[model samples]
Target: MSEPMSRRTLLGATAGTAVAAATGFVPAPATAAGNRVPAVVRELDAKIEEAMAAYMVPGVAYGLRYRGRDYVRGFGVTSLDDPQPVDADTVFRVASTTKPFTGTAVMRLVERGRLDLDRTVRSYLPGFRTADPAASARVTVRQALNHSAGWLGDYFLDTGNDDGALARYVDEMSRVPQLNPPGKYFAYNNAAISVAGRLIEVVTGVTYERAVRELLTGPLGLRHSAFSLEELPGVRWAVPHVPNEAQTEIVPQPAAWAMPRAINPAGGLISSARDQLRWARFHLGDGRVPGSDRRLLSRRSMHLMQSNPGPGGTLFVELDGVGVTWLLRPTAEGPKVVQHGGDWAGQHSGFLMVPARDFALTVLTNSDTGPTLLDDLFVGDWALSRFAGVHNLPAVPRALPAGELAAYQGVYTGEQIYFDGSTLTTQFEVVPDAGQLSVRIDGTEVARLAFYRRDYVVFPNPDGTVGNQRANFVRDRDGEVTWFRLGGRLYRRGAEATVQRRSSAPATLPRPILS
Candidate 1:
């Protein structure tokens, strides 16, 4: 961890005056009418600076559109080596934050009668399929957008970067095993979303990049956003950083591993704080092009994109369900806070909006620790409380009764599916420790588990903070624990001692079932 710096030191070193700007490319209303920064803006600035100093993030750029005003600012240097200060124009890989853009593009097509959300993948991308033939035909475009397609979502293969990349990606999906029946469960599936991007390409008869630009970014007048790094030249950009082996310092990662171009639709866009704010305002403002009366999408379609489809269970403590691509969390005050976050390699970015308040916040950072800071310092601490009126407190682990822990001790096995449709018989061993339970996969400790609800166990976040991902243990008619669901896929208990004894390292860590 980096030594914490005082706000005074941060202001003295890198603070800049906030600038007032138009909300979007179109001309409607000025985000800030006066030169003086608002109190909320000052508070957010201080919090960000404090977070940057404590987290050792090389740079951060953020913008907020609140109550008809826009505040955008940047702090610290772009890179420790370069020392070029970050500004509103500085671009960072938005990663999966790009999904909302693709979602908006699809909604636009839906409004124009060019596409149908209920249409199956086979109807559009005939080449798209899953290991289950029935599942492929049953999956619909809406399910793909909402991550309910039930296939493995973390498929991150690098098909060559080109116009045909999405097509090849869809073809590759033929090998991926379906995790759940279509629309039966919610799993954060990047491969499913990539298929949605391919659907956009097929329905519009244009490349996915071209479709996103023409339908969304181009209309919103997003100048510094692109599906690939090659689209933004001569523009300053932040490089991803990861902690060194000692875990006390940070270092830049190789550019090649930053983000794969083949997953462009799922999480490939490079954007700046300035451009992201405009994108946010577009969603908050009912699909109308900012600065003009022209409607990019019908208000009805815009609402559809933000509306929660069903009770898909929670991700974070407050997150309620999935919308088109937006994650919906209802506030205590009767309004919904719709948001999405993206992380690729070490770059972390968050886009959050409270439509009820006509407000939105965007944060972009260049460190693996950025997401933790974004949650701990910004979203979880300040943004949700101050703007959304929800005071999110850290969850305390409740001690389990002495005998209750014994019931969970056992070796469980399930079919683990890879991004490329490969499968492995995975084993999870739960052993009771002093009152707590330790979850082990193969020989490595995965997490310290605690009961969050009667049958649900929550693990800690990557930083050992309260985690949003959880496992719900299930029982059979005999009342014996038979299976468990984590990351939205079911893992059955080993059928016999032989299955339980055979264990191997997981190809990847289990992810949160929801995004």
Candidate 2:
């Protein structure tokens, strides 16, 4: 819960937009908090409201489920051209949160032993490739979800300007050398997730999109859910936004980025608060997604899907943390939390679960920059402290072992960098002049690169570290820290680094990125 602000005050903050918080994963069942919100939650609510105003979100949809009963609320209009009040019935894209459903779909076959995690990508998808034999041989479905497939984030590389171009970009990446070995270090790849979805289709004899709804959402009884614009619910959806350098929101024109048909599994699933609440209830252990005892699968499989599959370091976690998608960040209350957020056009949405407290929150916004505005609400010391209530966590995780992080200190380029080492990458962009600072990384760039945090002075540090950052290096017997840190992943430096590193240190390090 967060501090409360007057609805009038919030309205004036944006042209009219607001943010809501996304709690942690593994939520417990939520019940009424008596009549009043504890002082802590009230304070958090206010902070969230402030964050929304800062981001210029026009509308927000939020829900809190505690004990058994739940509370769902909405603010502002659902649409801009045709303004309508958003409510529990309004739908928003689940985005990457769709990974959990995708994961479940794959596991359905896994439980039946019809599919294997160790199988290579070509085993199922056959010709899936980018003309790079090395990448084609090494990439696998496990690597897709793990973000270890060596594919860099596509947001920077190509705009997918057209269907032909999007296909070429996917193929072009196939030819690029992988950043790390499959299942080694985590480097998120939305394309990889989509490919994984294709794997489900190959094995199940059903389209990946339909299989997920039929296997997971359908059993859960989620009525208002779909993957495409044509099959979607009514116009009760939030608009997505893009913020300017000043954090002022702007409506982005529909482009290759706005459409869904390209990468549906990676980040595309429109759903409602009422429906998502039930989805959150599953993780909260209410079990039986309001239907049969199919168990859908097993708790073991679900937990495995949720666990962190990183390269045993904080750096890897930064690339792709716990949970199949989004993140399973820990709370001050020691709660194993799971969360995900989305932004498309004027729509912004986020969802979270606090299992220990038996509570969960889902928020959707109608703003180009709403997801980011909504995300900032869940961050910061005071903001996080208030939402988790008292400090229940055993202790906070240090930035990571300096020595280990040093090994991870190269440039990392991938399909996307959601929040690489606190360095903002995807979904949040600060365009400078005619162009934005968006980067495209090959397999190697994922390590050396760091997102430049804006400062009046020392802007865009030529070095990988943002700000005057410090690093530590861990080496193997070869006294080589590269293999041990970057997990033996080879990142080819572009013209910029090709010259820079020559004047600094030797290009090659003996240790590879993985164990």
Candidate 3:
């Protein structure tokens, strides 16, 4: 184990900051014949400092690459006690960023003709089942890959580290009812991925660990990275500083390895900035690794993993192209940018790709609250845009016109809507929508909602809509609709549902809260 570091020694190491406007990307031996560009590294350094103070961050280690050159920096302590400074090579638990690796491994099987994307899970695992036994056998590999499997978020509370925890969890999931048909809605989930991981092991004829080693790192020469937390000889490590709100006494959990029992493929990988650079570049090459004709996956398959399938097509964060892999968001500089963020026990990280510029930005941290690093990254990116003379694009700005509010009104219900009004007490019930109700509380239009069209169309403002937007409604013993739903959060469905109308009327209200 590495000795814990102190804040004094950590801050003392970087001791001085460069006041220069910008610095060249740190030149590396590997770039002898590669393309490289100068970066505003000095500005990046100052911006990170500002974000740390802003996000109440404990410590951060980040890498930024523009053109082909790389720049790495760290701030605060890797460990609060005897604080240790973070550096480019310092390892941090990358959490969900590991998903792409799993995605890649699965795609490799596709290339080998070992697995069929549209085939049913029972075709391979044969153990698949659902609360609705008839529908359970119908889940396809694609549904599992995209998280369209109507499985409720993992029964995380009963989850614990043990030999057969995963098996037990899968059994529990087999009997749970679906919120809707597969491919019917999007619920960013984790349990399904762990099941996918085990499925990969069963099909690949190799342990999950060894399969990734041969498929990725070994071929790509990623020396300092691995799915496990075991440190390389002579390599120093940084553990995660987790936030624990449950304790009577506040405590920060230090993690050398992610909780691997239930969330492995979903969230469990430890890596360093140096090694991560290779991972980002792999995707940058259009998912090609070095020289082998992109072995294990066709270019078509690679793009499929990152491209949204248009309208009615599935898009859950867990379903890559949406989550932490990379989704293109248009920018003023003539191209759509792709990016993703990852969070673990005590760490946060983000990866953004600009194919037009062939650029990638990566940041990693050793503290749970490292989420603050994003503010700095965006600020630095904005400053970069200004320096390059490119204007930044304005946000999409959701919702109908202030005046057209009436046109966009009337209770609209769908399996996926994020409407959580003010009150914090609520739950999902049979009301307007049979499965999930997407009640948009647009008071600008006399508090009404309309039938939602697709996933995430509920871009209603943060009057409360920020994170998970679960709706709440009430259901009678016969499973009949009563009112709209938003759990732990309440919203009165206009006047009719608020005041019962012979008990046969629709009730839908918008709010954001867990149900």
Model 2, CA-based lDDT: 0.49
- Where does candidate 3 stray beyond 4 Å? 1-39, 154-168, 231-234, 242-252, 255-258, 286-288, 291-296, 308-334, 375-515
The residue-level lDDT of candidate 3 at 391 comes to: 33
> Model 1: clashing residue pairs?
26-291, 27-291, 28-291, 31-69, 31-70, 95-267, 153-189
On lDDT, the candidate that comes out on top is 1
**What would the per-residue lDDT of candidate 2 be over residues 1-515, giving only the tens digit for each residue?**
11111011112234533332221111122224445555544544454457555655555666666545566655555544445566676776766667667766777778888777668877875666743566667676666666667654332233243334334434444544345456655444566766777677667776666778778877888777777556663546655544443433454333412544446666667778778777887766633554456577677776766675644222211122534543565544455656655545455566766666666777776655454455344422233444545232222222333443333333322123221112222111111221112122222211222222111111123342232211122233565434222221223322222222222321222211011
The clash count for each model shown is 7, 76, 33
lDDT by candidate, in order shown: 0.69, 0.49, 0.49
Residues 1-515 of candidate 1 have per-residue lDDT tens digits of 11111011111122222111111111112236566666777777777767776666777888888768888877776666565667888999888788888888888888888788888878877766788888878888898998888776767666776678778877876777776678866556777778888888888899988888888888789999986667888999887777665555667774633554558888888899999998888888876888889888888888898895643544434356678988886655667788888766667788888888888899998876676567654445468676656543334567687689777777766554443445555566777776667766555565676676665666655455665444466665677776565544556566333444342423233432113
RMSD of 1: 7.1
Question: Model 3 shows how many backbone clashes?
Answer: 33
The residue-level lDDT of candidate 2 at 447 comes to 20
lDDT of 3 by residue, 1-515 (tens): 11011000112112223212112112222221344434455566666666555444556666665656665665655555545566667777676667677777788777788888788877887777766776768777777666566554333323445645555556656545455456544344455566676667778776566677887777877776765655356555676654444311112456434464546566666677767876776776766675456554566876776666311211211112242223344456655455555665566676666655656667786654455455335322453363333333332223443343332223423222211211122222222222222332222221212223321222123243322111223333464333232221112223222322232212233211110
Candidate numbers sorted by TM-score from highest down: 1, 2, 3
